[model samples]
Target: MADGILRRQIQLAAANLSEAIDGADGFQNTHQSQHCESAKFSIEQVVFILEKIHIMWESVLPRSIYRRSMFHVLGPVFSRITKDMLLIDDMAAEETLQLQGLIHLALENLSSLFLSLVENDDDEKFLDHHTWVQLDESIPSLKKFRKLAELLDMSLKSITAAWESGELANCGFTSSEMRNFIKAIFADSPLRKECLGWIVATPA
Candidate 1:
């Protein structure tokens, strides 16, 4: 019964976040320089919901359960953003730059929030744990989506270097995802072709 309630709460939060993300389509299409100063509304909504969860459940929930629940809430949220926003074709460079800045701010705020919620007892255990590590860095889809966000605004040279250095794979990107993102963000060119080939030949 308790688990069911928790699940419902998480689902509700996820739904709210998805709605916020859907509503942000207009903001995303425009060059909202002011909005990028903070996180996007959708991302801020996530942080707000998570903060509520931390306040309500942190004392009652087991540490592992609390951590897992947070990820459960975030997984769908990140997936929605990745699919609807990040994978767009024909995004202008200015838009990509703004999006990346928002992403970076979102990540920073999330990391800070996660760290603040860590209990004193958890300090030693989580001493080396970045939020991504503590919250489960093994979620490849989530990590890859973030990596793709960073890659979105990078130059072809930097991207190829990252691919060559295995950073993309290390960040949990699949070959297909890498290729698709490249195709979506960049135009056809010799360098783009070479990068795509490298992505295919190299194991992700």
Candidate 2:
């Protein structure tokens, strides 16, 4: 019941925002930024939900199938749903030209989560724990982020490429924020420097 209620609420909120966004100007048809700030709120909310679900996939999912089948049974299905929602957010952003604002933050969160898992990855215990059966950092995980990045790329192409290229100047993160996120999660590693560099260089 709670899940159903939450889904309904999200659906309603998305619908309301879609209507309001369609009516928004400049951010929609011109270089004039109007509703971007508000769109940031809605896009961030959706991004948070997707990020949580992605993380939960690690903590959930049965292990027996993962080891025996070498496949992500539930990960793809959930990922698709998350991807579609993010697509909607992206389409809205494109119409409004509001890229790398709130949606970017969501991708950052997703990337950070993936980077954290990768940093702490224990090859010895990989899937034996049965806790993260559908995560994307293991055997066939989808790197870190997906749909969010696709949208970001569609809107902001160079920055995403810069990030993938591991260019510190294009990491897509901020200096202080990158420092803090890296220091806390990545302590001492090549990836720590790589990610920080990309973030610092990533253009807002």
Candidate 3:
């Protein structure tokens, strides 16, 4: 019963993300206001899924059995999603569209991982090297995503600082929204810290 509910929730979340990606693609090259609105709606869908995944992590699954491998595979994905969602509101339309595609990719990978876990009933296999290999293979892409997100975050901060100091006035660049967004990104995302904790606890 729990598995059924969990699978249902995952499917719903994946479907929403897929729809968001398709919608974003359709709006690509449209007016900025329209594109931004679509992107914001898509981000809300992703955030909804993130919240569901967090609940599944804490409540649906047995922590003692699944915590290590489950978090191992999903932690970085969670971190990337949180970081990307935080930045999406301020990103250009094309960038948000690109991020939607990336989020879809992560969701696909996560669904496959969860399917594998369900099929292999033996808990022993969960922590085996094969599982580790599967989890490890995903790390590189996630690491790349995190690196890109960090760079983007830094760039946004620099741009915001420059604009605040009136250095970019001649360029007509202004960011009244970015400073508040950056603060909210860092201050509100406890999931980012939790995901990092899982990474740190992972064995080398």
lDDT of 3 at 40: 52
Candidate 1: C-alpha RMSD after superposition: 3.6
What tens digits encode model 3's per-residue C-alpha lDDT throughout 1-204?
A: 266775665566556556654555433432366765675565555555655565566565675434443444355445445444544444454554455454554444455344344335664544455554454354444433433333333444454444445543322222433343344334445653443343334322
Q: How many residue pairs clash in each candidate?
A: 0, 11, 0
TM-scores, each model vs. reference: 0.77, 0.31, 0.36
- Tens-digit per-residue lDDT, 98-189, candidate 2: 44344355455545443334333455433232333344435332322233344344413343354455542232233453245234323357
lDDT for predicted candidate 3 compared with the true structure: 0.46
* Index of the highest-TM-score prediction: 1
CA lDDT, candidate 2, residue 114: 38
Clashing pairs in 3: none
Which of 1 and 3 is ahead in lDDT?
1
Instruction: Output the better candidate (2/3) by TM-score.
Output: 3
Candidate numbers, best TM-score first, in rank order: 1, 3, 2
State model 2's lDDT: 0.40
What are the lDDT figures for the candidates, one per model?
0.67, 0.40, 0.46
